[model samples]
Target: MQIDPSATSHPALPFEYDVCVDRLPDIVTRETESAVRSGAIPTFVSTDGKTWVSYVDLFINMGQGRRLRDPASAFFVSPEAMRRISYSSDQIDAAGPDLSERNKVTLAGAKRIAATLAQLRKDLPPWPYDLRVPWSEDFDFPLAAFIKAGQLDAYPSGRCWWVRSVEATKLLPIGESFDDPASPWFVGPHGRADHAEVVRLSAAHRRHWPEIYGPALTPRVR
Candidate 1:
């Protein structure tokens, strides 16, 4: 979205539209217009511990959207399966002359992700979790499997990981110019009733599932 007209208030951050949309649950977006501000939510740390990246950026980059392949390729190996296979830099060098430099780098990065995921999985159970399921901080979500190796990183669920991104975190829908029903971001003042509506709508739109969009668009009568 064209630098949100509320730029003076929402001041932009370094993230892109899709990243912001994907990680909507992690951000606080329903505050008053004057209170809504832009910032980063540090979610993941680099394996080396020297740098960090937000969930949105990392999620999009690591086989989720735009930056990588679709989340359905054989690449997104399960965390359990990923943890099973050991990864090492030597594995790249030993790949021989046939392996291109780009592929070698990807392999090395995969090793890092595998290591990180292995460490994360230590605190959780060995079961496939759905990314589409409602997220809760109280529960340990399977982040490692969200997007792996350019795939939605699924088990038997067959759900997708890379959901659609939105143009804005919050839309006032206050004026005729700003209130366009055709726009997916359109949220009347009454929209405040359900803060998560934006995310639900975006995901449904991204998946092209009219069934979901239809129900979500039905106005709440509270």
Candidate 2:
């Protein structure tokens, strides 16, 4: 959907904090494209709207909390928006499998949501596989399942997903799941696969302070 031009200027109850939420799906879509094109890690914002960081900054040897917090980092919103957008953009356009019938299942009440969860439980791939990095193959099904099952909320700008369980904020963890050589979850600067720079910096620190920065600070070459 087209973003409201005034969304950039105004701040409302939920969408007030960031341009990402104010613009909703549109800004997220554009930002996803930008992040991909620029070879930067996808963005992740916490449900409470209090924290955000790029995957590279969060996981790699890079110092924590160093990257900018914004939607330009995340791909789809939570699973709900992800499904709807997939239905309209991929399904309707015949570019991907059509979940038309599945999409019609309303998440209005708890019962319906539960039923949807049941269907998703059967359809989704098993864990570990489901927890793979977003850019990996077969990632969407498990992610959609998690959202429907009230395990994850990926909405841009940090608003909680509509279908998540109350305890999800505490139970479910978001972001990269595993380390893969093909698509390493944590990369060096600018999301590059090589961690040489991170290693070099750590080595330099070790050389300077042999006792202080010891083995704990050693960079893992993934």
Candidate 3:
């Protein structure tokens, strides 16, 4: 759908804010595309409309607060708007199969936005596979499963998938899952397999982290 040009100057909200409560999905859908297309940035406005980063940011990044100004502006959705998309903020990592309500809103919005943007700009990067990143034969199924679970967050940006790396202790754990390369669960920055895939396979189950990726306890070890 085409963005309504009339919405350009949001009347009521602050200059920093983009879309408001009443028109979140459509306006956000448009803005997300602009970010990927023309590079427009966004910020989540607070419930009071006085604050820049909404309470939603706290729910993401393990309450450490999101990086609002740099890297890229996160969708500045208000709590009221957040309700339109999801319910909670609990996460498996910085991002994962089940993202919080705010995150779900952001991601779903990105998929629609990016898909549309890709069509308009041929120069925009295509899917990751076309970049010659060397995928394992079995990559498709689990990756599809992950996408189906709504966990993958690498959006269609100009370069590689924009995997938003978060604090080491949060989503996408910082350390190696297994020290032994012979183990099936080994994970690191540069593994024999795809790094993101290895991380996803070994760490997607955040709630069960202690039980997973432990080679000695792994079934593969036996």
Candidate 4:
């Protein structure tokens, strides 16, 4: 599988390949792209089963300013359950020893996400999936869960708590040269669509599936 050179424009943000492959709906793609360009930040917008939850791959360009890199997460926001937890009056430490330093979180953002999830609990008849950051907002721990832990800070209010989870990281595929097998993104006998290494590639070389390579996505047995 190879990316269609003729079918793409410069992927300014990650997951732009998602838009090209029809895994992400056109409406959601357009809306997310618009918000990212405007600097609101890539967000977990919505989903209709056509694709997973939509988010942006944000980056700070050298001179252009804060913008999304070309790409979106390939993993679907897991359609799982969430438990509501409240921090004790005596705040606990937030940052878990396991959490990484590649990213940071804010107390306010943590609170906000917690509140959002709480509201979603009340609003949605059934909890959809775990509320995930647009990207690796915090792969390891959900920000709200660690609020009382003092992982972020003791700030009471007027601050947004944001966590960069190290557990999961989704990035925009920056199409670097990968014609060589040495390249992590190289397409070869093992180039399954869902391969973690393949997903990391900035390009979706899906021009030929089942023929040159097996289906990146498993085809319906039927």
Query: Is candidate 2 or 3 superior in lDDT?
Result: 3
Clashing pairs in 1: 71-151, 71-152, 72-151, 75-149, 76-148
TM-score, prediction 1:
0.21
Give the whole-model CA lDDT for all candidates, comma-separated.
Answer: 0.28, 0.30, 0.31, 0.28
Error of 3 at 77 (Å): 20
Q: Pick the candidate with the highest TM-score.
A: 1
Best first by TM-score, ranked: 1, 4, 2, 3
The digit string of per-residue lDDT tens for model 1 on 136-160 reads 4464223323334333333322332
Residue 217's lDDT in candidate 3: 39
TM-score-best of 1 and 4:
1
Stretches off by above 4 angstroms in model 4 are 1-23, 40-99, 102-112, 119-222
> Judged by lDDT, which candidate is best?
3
User: For every candidate structure, what is the RMSD over all alpha carbons to the true structure, in angstroms?
Assistant: 20.5, 23.2, 18.8, 25.1
Clashes (candidate 4): 40
Model 4: worst 10 consecutive residues (lDDT sum): 58-67
Candidate 1 segments exceeding 4 Å error: 1-94, 125-222
For candidate 4, the TM-score is 0.20
